[model samples]
Target: MSRAKNPKYESMSLEELRANMEKSKKELEHAIHNKNILEQRKRIVERKERSHRLIVKGAEFEKAFPLSRDLEQEEVQDVMEQLQNSSYNKSIVRQVYIAALHKEQQQIAEAVERAEKGDDS
Candidate 1:
């Protein structure tokens, strides 16, 4: 049986790269429809490698490529505001609130890192 070379497209030839990108795009669209976190993450990693290849090849990649809406700024802000204003037992709320904050921070950090690296994802 033949092996799957790699899911990453950066080091692949042009045809392989395009195929990988198309696969990623379709997976992303499907993930959007079904709201699957695993598919969404697979898309992120695949597309990020695609973007890196485009950069290396001097292609003009679109800056406004659609991003997944799962962890948007508005949602994070709403969660933060709710955590701050809601009255609850400190012992109970603190751990949950801190966990949410940590998750939000990780999402923000990932987004910023992707942005800095020129991946519009």
Candidate 2:
């Protein structure tokens, strides 16, 4: 047999209804407080993300503007133009440009091979 519903909810006096309304209001207030806390957490995370993006952007800007190189800008540009025209393996180009003794050259070749194999430290 189905149980009967509570009479207080089914047909309450005015005072009883007001009491129930007050209870509902308190629950609603608690929910609003929790929502505000969640919103504050979201803002904190968003701020952190924005800060990380700014840091990355700053690093990129520095790379594109290497400090104290202004005196040699023209010469650097000329070499850069030559490198662009050469169409060389740019990754190993720095090592190739530095002349070395025979033993050092052998070591460099081995290092490059290892690096290409994803094994170099």
Candidate 3:
């Protein structure tokens, strides 16, 4: 609470203050509900984006290894493990990761430059 009170509130009748407090409480609850809905929508959009990326990766995987499409989850895990165990695959993965990192950095730099120029969306 504040040490000082507003004269407006001090002059309000007890019933009027109670009504005003209830109205404020309802507005706060409504705002909280709206915030929760927006958060939920954001989570859903994130999940959808992740799902799309996974689906695209799966499609790419199937294109690379057609026979593996029919395999079970454990088999896929085994294949991934085997790939990871291979030095050639590890090197390839590293190269791809580095390329991706560079691309991301370039994109970020471009975005920053745009922002500096006040042209960023």
Candidate 4:
């Protein structure tokens, strides 16, 4: 991207300089538009991926508790509240939460190690 030294700028007419300024403005506008398109597409993909994940999770949940498919939302919430109120279920929930957190930490540590190795190379 290095530009070669030229004496043309010193001798160029005012009109020439104005044309170059206009060209730069157009280039800047196009660059911004291109970046905005890419960002918009990225957001669209993220939204679609999230929707797909939720659909998959819903299907799995329905498979596990077929009766839940017929139950109202309030009923489901009520059932979950009761489960949480029970000490046994509460303990189990905490254990599951801790396990998930530990798994996430391990994954992050692994990623950091991989990144460090890459940097070393």
Candidate 5:
């Protein structure tokens, strides 16, 4: 025969009520621990995905300028930040690289010119 459901909790003895309260607290703590574990796993997955995307994008940027030196991870990260902060079109990755190179060259040339003038003085 099918067993009857447990009797109403209101009819339970004081000891029974205390036992139930302890059981309920344990269940609540277990549920909370599981929830925290799942959140940690989720964060780990998100971090891996972000790192993978950065690696792939950095490789793509390098591919576009095959003759140029490969960009270091820090340089790629800086460019990524700039791309995110600016309104430039994402497709112009090569152009961005070239522009940055030109700017660096200009800065170096200006510094050399100043140094030569100082030496002459």
Candidate 6:
């Protein structure tokens, strides 16, 4: 029988990563209870690797496209309420937020460029 190749954890979706973590936890527990030293060590290493992958993914996501923190509480609540009232999915909401943030940043950059070019008005 041929063995299946394991997929790389870094490329896994969040849900898949969580599932892998749960599986690794169970395997580690079983290895510990069975007193299998080799399996226990292997499971520990796998679990740590998965955890590191998750952390790196989170960091990359935050760095590449972060939500705006300048929004006031009232504005945030209003957006949340509107989103809740609509049938929009989480992905749609995320896209809207990212688009708004990108537009705002672009406007700021353009204004700065104009000011640097000696255009005070």
State the displacement of the C-alpha of residue 41, model 2, in Å, after optimal TM-score superposition.
Answer: 1.1
| Candidates sorted by lDDT, best first | 3, 4, 5, 6, 2, 1
- The reply for model 6, stretches above 4 Å from the true place, is 1-35, 68-121
RMSD of each: 23.1, 14.5, 2.3, 5.9, 20.4, 20.4
Q: Assess the local accuracy of residue 12 in candidate 3 as a C-alpha lDDT between 0 and 100.
A: 99
Candidate 5 versus the native: TM-score?
0.54
- Please report the candidate that would top TM-score against the real structure: 3
Question: C-alpha displacement of 14 in model 4, angstroms?
Answer: 1.4
Candidate 4 lDDT over residue span 1-121, tens digit each: 9988678787888999899999999999999999999999999999999999989977887898899889998997887688679999889979999999999999888889989889533
TM-scores across all candidates? 0.27, 0.45, 0.83, 0.64, 0.54, 0.29
Give the clash count for each candidate. 0, 0, 0, 0, 0, 0
lDDT of each: 0.73, 0.79, 0.97, 0.90, 0.83, 0.80
Between prediction 1 and prediction 5, the one with superior lDDT is: 5
- Model 3 lDDT tens row, 8-114: 99999999999999999999999999999999999999999999999999999999999998999999999999988999999998999999999999999999999
Worst 10 residues of 3 by lDDT: 1-10
lDDT of 3 at 56: 99
Instruction: Name the regions of candidate 2 deviating beyond 4 angstroms.
Output: 1-10, 68-121
True lDDT of residue 75, candidate 2: 69
Q: How well is each residue in 2-119 modelled by candidate 6, as lDDT tens digits?
A: 9776668657999998998999999999978878878788999999999999889656645653663466768757765775777666678789999999999999999999999999
| Best of the two (1, 2) by TM-score | 2
lDDT over C-alpha atoms for residue 54 of model 2: 82
Cα deviation at 38, candidate 2, in Å, is 1.3
Candidates 4 and 6 compared: the better one by TM-score is: 4
Best by lDDT: 3
